[model samples]
Target: MSKTSLSLALATALAGIVSMPAAIAGTPSGAFSIFKNCPYTNPSVTTCLYNVVSSGSFVIGNTTLPITSPITLQGGLESVGPSPLYDAVGAPTLASVPAKVPGGLLGIANPAPDWPFPLWVAFWSIVNSVNDVTATIELVDTVQTNFLQALYPPAPDSGEDPVAARLTVRVHLQNPFLGGTCYIGSPQNPIRINLQTATTNPPPPNQPISGEPGNSYYVWVDEANYVGYIQDDDNSLVDNSFAVPGASGCGNVALGLPIITSVLDFLVSGAVNLKVGLPSAAGKNTAIMSGDTSLAASAYVLASEQ
Candidate 1:
């Protein structure tokens, strides 16, 4: 079959599974079952994407959290422009599902202070008991993301390797002690993570790091049709030069008492920043997402809808 015909056939098969029907929200079956979340109704959408970050580590300043839970990223890419700007308009559908920060608050670099003081000692004692605290990195804005940059391998450049999957994110710290509003970064002052699937050249204090696109192979929808390719396990997205803001609103809540809540918020925020090394410099932090990625044409997805 010709490239155009093959592309259409491949997209048709993939889209058949992804954009089956708006009425069908249940689980999808078959080889293309993984793309169940593709937004078929969106006319502007031109690409279907599903990626799972199985294992990786995010090092922020003094803390290093291993990815225990899988991080899922799924949605459609709009036919806005070219390359990375394809999703720049028409209400982009890409969504980055936040994953838990492994060990939660206990996973931080320094859970307790070295020198035991009066107020600090009391704080640490209480914090140590609150083992349910967990942190999750959430995307602050989808517009700040670059899908193409993350999807394709980087090219050799005379200049620095640009950030891949460039995203603005905030870390939500959840715990009774920290409160629901507690966050390491905010929408206004988010942590900008510039991930890349290539070698990084960060500033001082951070050494260079590398990433890979992993094994690539095309999917066969059937004997006569060829679907989009899949980036199997081993794909790595890395960045070691992103700044992290300090924690805020920690323990900030009106739990029947105003004074107690204010005090708790202050104490918790201070402790978290001090231990996690908040407001860290660009070179002091790192993020690596390793997973499998599947892609299909949006045209086919929409065609399947009809």
Candidate 2:
């Protein structure tokens, strides 16, 4: 017998089949957007997810390289997290708050019999100083898979699968400044985001490769070098190109809500792009690949004044 998870109310809601919320008057109802895959009231159709693959070439100084295996990403269905789409800066904190987040929320879930998906939070920064962009990305893979996983059940299953390696490079702005140093994590560290059903991601690479999910990475621009790069925990460089950020004194998240809107949202309001066939120090744009990661999310405007 599989152990049933979710409260009776939540399960009832799931059984009821909740439809996408309708759009507001002038707010441009987001209901019909791309995020309709994960509906709060229905779990059968919750197949929303994402993958990371190399798309094309990225040039830096005089070097370029092809994207290979070992660098990847995958989430949705089996992986989940707090992705509450907010327009504020410094939303989540990195301190004691993590203990407060719902556990086992960022990976594939069994749903019943056994919910072994432990609670975890992914904290990384996508900084693009060249283009002046930064995002304290927090992907809380809810481990909320389909009810079928639970129904069939796996013997001591972690409930997570290999989501192809993912890496998204966007040329944009920077994060909110504080006291002289800056970092990602909106509202505050250990923030809670998985408020509703969301499923959005960058397009897969034009080709194929291998990698895993539930990994960590961070990218930033070298002001001294005036270029972008991806770095792993070992301080190893991942990519030759990355997005840039708007510099310090670049303004901040909002003074206290309404009056001050975060540039993080405003800057990202633009497109996440990729380019190929650029000059490089490697004689060839070897850094160029045929894959890309869409670090995007689906959201709906519940209420609007307009």
Candidate 2 residue lDDT tens string, 231-267: 1121111222222222122223332323233432232
TM-score of each prediction = 0.75, 0.18
Q: What C-alpha lDDT values do all the predictions have?
A: 0.62, 0.23
Global lDDT for candidate 2? 0.23
Off by over 4 Å in 1: 1-29, 79-129, 143-152, 158-161, 227-229, 252-263, 302-306
Assess the local accuracy of residue 150 in candidate 1 as a C-alpha lDDT between 0 and 100: 52
Per-model RMSD to reference: 5.6, 22.6
lDDT of 1 at 300: 42
lDDT of 1 by residue, 146-207 (tens): 44445454465746344556677888777655568988889999988777787888887999
